[model samples]
Every structure is written in C-alpha cells, then in structure tokens.
Target: MFASNPSKRRQMILLVIITFNIISTWLHYTDNALFLSQYPGPEWFTSVGVISAVVVMTPVGLLGYWFYSKGIFWLAYLLLGLYSITSVSSPGHYFFPMVTPISWKMHSLIWLDGIMGVLLIGFLLWSSVVLKEWRSTSVGN
Candidate 1:
C-alpha cells in the first residue's frame, strides 16, 4: 500500500527502528530495576514507573505512525519527535554518577537506545525536508 508514496515508505522504516528502540528502553529499564541502579529520577521511579514510562511512550510512537499513515503530517511529526526524545534521553543515565560498574548488557541497551534515537532524529529531519520539497513541487505543478 505504501509503495506509491516514498514518505510512507520512509515512515514505515522509521516505525520499525523506533519500535526496536522502544524495546531496548524496556529491556534496559527492566535490567536497571532488577539490578537496582541509582536511576536519576523521582523516588517513585521504580520498576512500576519504568514499566509505566514504556507503556505510555509506546502508544505515542504508534499513534505518530498511525497519523502519518492517515496523512496527518503535523500531529505525526509532533508525536514522532516526542517519541524520539524518549530514546535520545537514554544517555542521560551516564551524566549522573558512576559509583559501580554496569554490566555489558546494560551498557549495550543504553547505547542501543541512544543510537536508535539519533537515527530516528536524522530520518525525521530528512523526511521533513523531503516533504517540504515534495509539497512545493507538487503545488507548482
């Protein structure tokens, strides 16, 4: 169905990547909770809160893709950007403290989430530019 529209194709790819990023976040958080890391957040930022964050953010990314598929570009852009923020912020874990060494699994999860976020942000910016050009040229025709 999306073969005809390049934007749709790009959005689909982004959706998949972001989904993985979300999963990485979930895994990292679950690991963190299990190991009892000093997560830099509120006192309530326990396992439940970690779960809640993923639960809340997952819908935002999905809804963004849904909106994009329906051609609601403005809202889709907003939600997708918000979703990207969640992933990009994963590196904030490094800024606080380094009391004890983290396992390789946790390190991998954290970097994976952050790297995916960077990819998502890059794609979003490129997509916006393509969209603007596509619109202008279409309007001219």
Candidate 2:
C-alpha cells in the first residue's frame, strides 16, 4: 500500500537498499565468536556489540520504512542520504581508483559499504527529479 502511490517510488528503492543494509549488518555480526575475535575482550563490549548493533540499526530501518510509507519520502530519503555518505566516507583510503579486481578482494567491507553508499546516493539524486515531476503533474491533474 505504501508503494502504490506514484510519488513514492523512491520509497520502494530505499526499502530495497535499507533491507539489504539490515541483512548485511546482520551477516557481519551473526557469528559472535568471529566478532569477538576481532576485538580485544573488554568484557562489556564483547557482550554487547552484536546486541547494540541490532538495537541501533533495526529502529533506523523501521523509522525509514515508516517515513516513506507515510508519504514523508523526503524525510526518509534525507536520513538515508546522510547515512550513505557517512558509510562510504568512513574509509578514507578507498576513495582513489584501484585498478585491479584481485587487489579488490581484500577489502570486502569497505567495498560493500562504499558501493551501497554510491547506490543510495545515485537513487536519491535520480528519485528527487522523478518525485518532483510526479508532484507537479499530480497537482496539475
């Protein structure tokens, strides 16, 4: 029902992106032992890292969903736009071109985060124009 509105196509695109984000976050944190191995045992951090991630990301995804579904597409898109930029920008080293696929294999998280960031940004820019046209035409009719 949320996606049925012509002006809300951006919401559909973002739903896909956010869903993938949630899945990726879950996959990255699923193995507790592996996650713990990556960090020094702070006891508290080791116990709480995965739970914290779920707590934080879930509400964000849900809020985005709610905003878009309610036709407040711009608000949802704005939040996600900010998120995507930060995710991609966080790894400062990867901004320059990397000429080889073989070399690319080593930095999976950086690549995934960066790529998702690009996708989200691209979609937002495109959908802004689309929603604008739709609003103008819908209002005219």
Candidate 3:
C-alpha cells in the first residue's frame, strides 16, 4: 500500500522491528522456566510461570506492535526512547542469567533497543520530509 520506495522501506523496517521485539520477548523467558533462573524453582510455580509467561507475552507483544503501527508514534518513541536510554546506563550483570559474566547480552539488548529508537525517529522525520516535498511539488499542478 505504499506509494514510493521510501514508504515501502519504512514499512519493512517497522515490520522487522515489530518481529524482533516479539521474538525477544519470547526468548527472554528462556529454557521454559520463565527467565530461567540460575537456580531451580519450585515445581508447581515453575510450570505455572512458564505457561503464564507464554500466554501473556505473546499477546502482549502483538498488542505493542499494533499500537506502534496504528497509534501516535511520538508517544511510543517518547516512552521507548526513554527506556532505551535508561537501560544502557548500567551495563554489567544485575543478578540475572546472562550468556556471559561480562553481560554482553544485556549490553547488546540495550544497544539494539537504542538503535531501534534512533531508526524510529529517523523514519518519522523522513516521512515528514517526503510528504512536504510531495505537497510542494504537486501544489501548482
């Protein structure tokens, strides 16, 4: 439904971001133990937690994608951009199961989120510029 190559590229970028967020949320639950603690959990609670995380996170991710696509992007950008900035402030491990003790996974997550925020801002500005040019070019015709 996009009219130009830039529009198509924007849509594709958005789709990729949406998909990445969804998958990240899923993987965050890890090892089917709901965050996959460095230690084991109680039997009933562990089962319940995993089931609950899957049930909740799938729809939650989809809903977030829907909101980002249909709602005011500035709102999402404001909240998520703030979050991205805050997340990178502390890069080391914080009592969680990271791939490495140095916390590269955590750092990568923050960096990826920050990059996404930057991309969103860029896309919004690019869209406005494209629209303005189109309007200016078409006005006399």
Candidate 4:
C-alpha cells in the first residue's frame, strides 16, 4: 500500500521501455527475414538494417541499465529521444513494407512504432526538464 519511490518508478519505466524496444526490434528482424524470403532486398539494405538495429538497440538497452543505476538519466533520455525520433521517421527506411498490398499483420507494428516514438519524445522532454532542475539545484548547493 505504500507509494513507490520516484527512482523506483523511473527504473520500472526504463525496464519496460527496454523490454518493449528489444521485442519490437526482434519482431522487425523476423518480419524482414520473412519478407526477404519472397523478395530479397538489396544486400546494402540488409546490411543497413542489421547495423541500424544494433546501433539503436544497444544504446537503448544500456541506457535502461544506466537509468536503473541512477547514473546517467540524461544520456538515457537523449538516446531514447533519438531512437524514438528515428523510429517514427522510419530510420533507413527499414520499416517500409517490402511487398505490395502490405498485410494487415504489419499494421500493428507501424502503429506501435508511431506511438512509441511519441511517448519516448515526451519522456525525453520531461527528463530534460528534470535534468535542468537537478543541475540548477546542484549548482545552487
């Protein structure tokens, strides 16, 4: 019945985000593989997909740990912000449907990406404000 501490809440949020991002990225890879089976994209496209996925997921996962440790929330926020923005924009056009008449199955992913982007951006902005306050308080002390 006791209220959770703010840091604990933040840790929970970070964990949730990291889990969601990992699952989403894995699903994207699965979808890509299936799509490629029928219609293989250029080699460069696949390479880019693999590289970008690594780049985005690695930092996100690391940042979540950082958040849990209460060590670098600002950096985590920045990384999440970048990931969210890129996800929304279809970074590297990796999310673009490979086949014509895109199946209904993929729709959920598109929507998820969009929603996560907005949420992450909002979280990032809120964290930035918190960071500013923390900095000011420390400076004052």
Which model scores highest in lDDT?
1
Better candidate by TM-score, 1 or 2: 1
Q: For residues 1-141, could you state the per-residue lDDT of candidate 2 as single tens digits?
A: 745665566456577887776554454344333544443223454536655755565676567557656656667666666556534552443444443432332356545656766776676667666545324433211
lDDT of 1 by residue, 97-122 (tens): 76577777777877888888888777
lDDT of 3 by residue, 24-141 (tens): 4344334334344432334343746755755664554445344445444445344443433222222222433444343455445545544554554464455445543223232211
lDDT for each of the candidates?
Answer: 0.72, 0.54, 0.44, 0.53
lDDT at position 84, candidate 3: 32
**Candidate 4 error regions (>4 Å):** 1-4, 37-44, 64-68, 91-99, 130-141
Report the backbone clash tally of model 2: 0
Query: Candidate 4, residue 63: CA error in Å?
Result: 3.1
> TM-scores across all candidates?
0.80, 0.55, 0.41, 0.65
lDDT for position 26 in model 2: 50
> Candidate 3, which segments miss by more than 4 Å at Cα?
1-8, 30-45, 71-93, 96-141
Q: Can you list the residue pairs that collide in candidate 2?
A: none
Residue 13 CA error for candidate 1 (Å)?
Answer: 1.6
How large an RMSD does model 2 have?
Answer: 7.0
lDDT sort, best first: 1, 2, 4, 3
Residue 87 in model 1: lDDT: 79
lDDT of 1 at 48: 72
Ranking, TM-score, top scorer first: 1, 4, 2, 3
Best by TM-score: 1
